[model samples]
Target: MELLLVEDDERVSRFVRRGLEAEGYSVTAAQDGVAGLSRARAESYDVLILDVMLPGLSGRDVCRQLRKAEVSTPILMLTALDHTDDKVECLRGGADDYLTKPFDFEELLARLEALARRGRGFSSEPPAVLEVGNVRIDRQSMRVLLDGEPVELTAKEYQLLDLLLSSPGRVFSRTRILNKVWGYDSDPLTNVVDVYIRRLRGKMRWDRDTGWIRTIRSYGYRLDPTI
Candidate 1:
């Protein structure tokens, strides 16, 4: 995922950039709201994280301006304000979500993932079931089926398959897979992704060379639904 982080505090910006980079997100940081606004207008990102307190312009104004300009990229506001009115203001300013200072990293990650999945803000629509070939997954129920038969999958396996299904025919690099499935703490050198891919194939009754899952020599894997 590509992200734009607008923050003034050096420490906070550094910490967020490092953490997101570790998770396979390409991030660009801006020190003030004006620079952030410029970058945001100039480039596209999967998401934007804005600090409420910023130099030159305030985060609320940035969000409001982006919305006014019809930039639909999801925005997550970070602030020390914890009051209900503060959160309402952030939302009213067009932020998709709000996170308070000193929050748990896990929560931040979860909210970002949720926002990305939700797409373009707090959408009210539910995700449609994803299917490729004979494999299908119901996002609402977290159910997987192979050839119309229910297939029980481990949480990790389910997540891996879901990622592939999310974008059929799009190759997912190993680093990207590791960060998305196993997280940043997983050893970069570990072959666990390979092992799990094999396991997922076996469970789905896919032969090594004749499956929808294709290994992209030395790169990673892709789900070729057309197969």
Candidate 2:
């Protein structure tokens, strides 16, 4: 999932951006309201976390203008103040959810996920790591672990694992894997898939007992957690 955070406070923006990125969600940030609004307009994001207090445009105005402009991406307003009217105004202005400053990170993630799910009917899972058998992938930190120990992998290897781990059990054919991981499909004769699979198996220490990656004859590969 892609997210845009429009916050002015450098400390807060850095903290939230780092935290969100670690959770596996692609995140882009803008320091102030004008820049935030422009970015949100120019690109597509699954969710937008906007601070109520901003430099050029207020978060409320941004929300109103977004709705006015027909941008329906979910907006979760952040504020230091927790007033009754503040909550009312946030919703009234077209924001989807609200979170106060100094709030719990876990709670923030939960609300953000919920709002995103409501918007797109997709997983809102963040801060929580994705697990497959003994392999754990943290989307936020882009960290991968095997059996509680850190396992080093190349960027492409991690992306491939992330793709497989994101949707377990479903077979990802070589062509699909190539298109997704490499962002383009080469000639059908490439042996890239087999090579990466070997590297992943070697690094992950897969075996008949582990049975992490399953070869479906001539079809493709799937992550079989049952192993």
Q: Which candidate comes out best when scored by TM-score?
A: 1
Tens digit of per-residue lDDT, candidate 1, span 124-208: 5646798778888998888999889999999999999999987786777786788788876447579999999999999988877
lDDT of 2 at 160: 91
- TM-scores, all models, native as reference: 0.62, 0.58
Cα-based lDDT at residue 208, candidate 1: 74
Candidate 2's residue-wise lDDT over 77-166, tens digit each?
A: 999989999999999999999998998766787688788788896655544688877888988888999889999999999989898887
Q: Scored by CA lDDT, what does every candidate get?
A: 0.88, 0.86
Q: Give residue 41's lDDT in candidate 2 (0 to 100).
A: 91
TM-score of 2: 0.58
Model 1 alpha-carbon drift over 4 Å, by segment: 22-24, 67-72, 113-128, 138-160, 167-201, 205-227
- In candidate 2, which residue ranges exceed 4 Å CA deviation? 122-227
Root-mean-square deviation of Cα positions for candidate 1 versus the true structure, in angstroms: 5.2
